[model samples]
Target: MKWLLAMLLLGTCTTALAQEATARQPEPNTRVPQGVMRYAPSGFPDRIVASPAQDARTGFSVAWRTDTTVGAPLLEIVVAGDSPDMGDQRRITATSVALKTENGSAHHHRADVDGLQPDTLYAWRVQGDRTWSAWHHTRTAAKASAPLTLLYFGDTQNKNVSLTTRVVREAMRHAPDARLALYAGDLVSGGDGEDDNEWGEWFEANEVLPTSLVVAPAPGNHEYFEEFEDTPQERRVLGAHWPVTFALPGNGLAEAKRTTYWFDYQDVRVVVIDGTSALDLGTAKAQAAWLDQALASNPHRWSIVLTHQPFFSPREGRDNVPLRKHLLPVISKHKVDLVLQGHDHVYGRLKSPPPVFVVSVTGAKQYRLSDEARRTMRPVAEDTQLFQVLRFDGPRLRYEARTATGRLYDAFDLVDGGERGKQLVERDEDRIDERACTRAETLKGRTDRCWE
Candidate 1:
């Protein structure tokens, strides 16, 4: 009996030790590598993306990343013809910048291809040494007053491989001729926004789509993360990959050019602002001054502003009052047509405005709206993934908000009133019912109750 009792105690000690060891181990799939370089050449170029230049008709920019083996950036383009001949085409060398990241050192290359004809189709590709990327075709924007359509998404920052992949795919499948893809920021899950695996997933997810799609993204708070040795006093900075990976227009003020820029497509002028840096680093004054100039100089008939944080907060205890205090006056003064934003993780549309403010999310993460927010905003959606398409032509701008599964949920139109202004025309047919909670549920300990 003594021997048996001793064996049982020994077994208990072993089990406890095993449990402790397991507990001490790091979480699975959470280990971030210090660098991502392989000894051999990573071969072909990756993350190939295009952005609208200061002028979209005759100018556009292309950016891509490659391993160190590719010392110089090269691109080849041709005015596509029925039987395009590569006989006289010349390859142009682009500007390459070395980017050393936790994953490894790679070169980010950017080329500004200019002097192309408006609304003309062209084929292009990037080359690394002798290896070349597949030929991709793109067309320049048509002259002002021409019809145009664009895809808009919000907060594609989580589960990019599984969820964002589906959302983007659905949007592209629905609208193959979309001229531009606009994101409201939070493009990755990593707090730093530069994680190699996270970026890889993003690139892979987008690879299946057309490489010519121009991306215009706003910077979110998640794009700025703290970096240090774990004690938490480190200052937050913009993600290392943000500027290098994207080649945007240089039409912004000092220090915030990448996140704060503007470009005109057809009759619409899109003004992108950097709300994260403004609220965190106290750069609001400079950004506001720049926004005033941008709006004042708008040559297009329709104006829209895009940012990560909304001017009006839609969730309880979640607000960006400082952002609003600085930019609302400018928006009002300019009579901005639309203010598109993300980070609320919920969907909301306001009826009141010189500017119609819309908050939406495309990722899987969600949040319940506060009572005040629900009561104030019309047509609020919860736990729904959405993508929006906006078409601008002549005297009308049409907007449709669709779910991930291609269901049209909300629709509206803005008609230009000539000397007066743009008037909102709401389409209420086949709209989904409001998904708000009841007051009775709130009385029974529910916090996300809806308004009557």
Candidate 2:
């Protein structure tokens, strides 16, 4: 009887080993020929972000990722607008290059589809031989003749692809037809692919809507990696993947190039600034001088300013005082309509003198709203994930804040232009209690914890 029991146990062990062996076996035809560098598939359709430029009303830039082996790749484009007929689809092609990530090689592909009709819907896809992704749709910004809606998000620093994805997905569902989406930076964590997987997750999480969504991103401090162990700032990868993936306007502050650029859609002049550059990473004087010229020459009906750091932060030390001193006055003098920023990891909308400054976070990370902030802020949020949807109708703009679960947290409107742009019309609502902290302890592992 003991021998029989031992034999039965041996049989079970043999069965388990066989299953393990089978699972470990590589599929046939999976191996590349010798002398050829094996190209492991990765970074495909990641950070699937978009931006409007080059052709403003008719063109958009798209970026995605893939593993290193896929040499120079190309993008495929298709248009699916209000027309119900399946025959309206049109296709175009674009090229791509590779961006280095720590864990492995990642490629970013971008294409700007031009000659599209204004205020029309379009669908697109990306591919590399056996790796074609599905179709994603986007609506071009409406012409001045009609009203339009846009989506805005901030930070998205922590748990990027995991918890933050839900917030992005929710925002997309809440306003799937939004003409554009804006990001306030820190789009990913771990400067040099230290948490490379998080970047993948960040891209995957937004893939559902990014394929169709137009994205504009400003660089955050997290996007940079201080040179390894006491070396001066060396490997700078600001918007390396960013520009390669999205075809942004090459025209920016003359010195800053793509890092600081401007685009026009209908009546709105959207200017993106690199807060890092203004904060002394390079020549602040040069960037500041350029910003003044850029703002002064704008002729659009409304001007919207975007950056990664807040000019008026509730977090005491985090305020970009130098930047404020240099840029705020220009914004006021030029009658900039709205100023959007992130970095404090909270939401703050303040009615300053001219420009209505708004600081918000759309990622999973959160911070505490100070009591002083409550008194000055038009709307303040703490410990919550949120996004903004902005609609433009000629001279009037309607803005709404939607929570991660698709609840309308806040809404407001702005009307007219020039001097009238200084006046704001805020919607009345009961003040909401601050969101509670989700984790037991804050990730105080770094010095940049003022907001937390």
The digit string of per-residue lDDT tens for model 1 on 78-99 reads 8776775745555778888887
TM-score of 1: 0.86
Candidate 2 displacement at residue 383 in angstroms: 1.2
Q: What lDDT does model 2 reach?
A: 0.69
Q: Which ten residues in a row have the lowest lDDT in candidate 2?
A: 25-34
Q: Model 1: runs farther than 4 Å from truth?
A: 1-41, 84-87, 192-194, 208-210, 228-233, 435-452
What TM-score, over all chains together, does every model reach? 0.86, 0.80
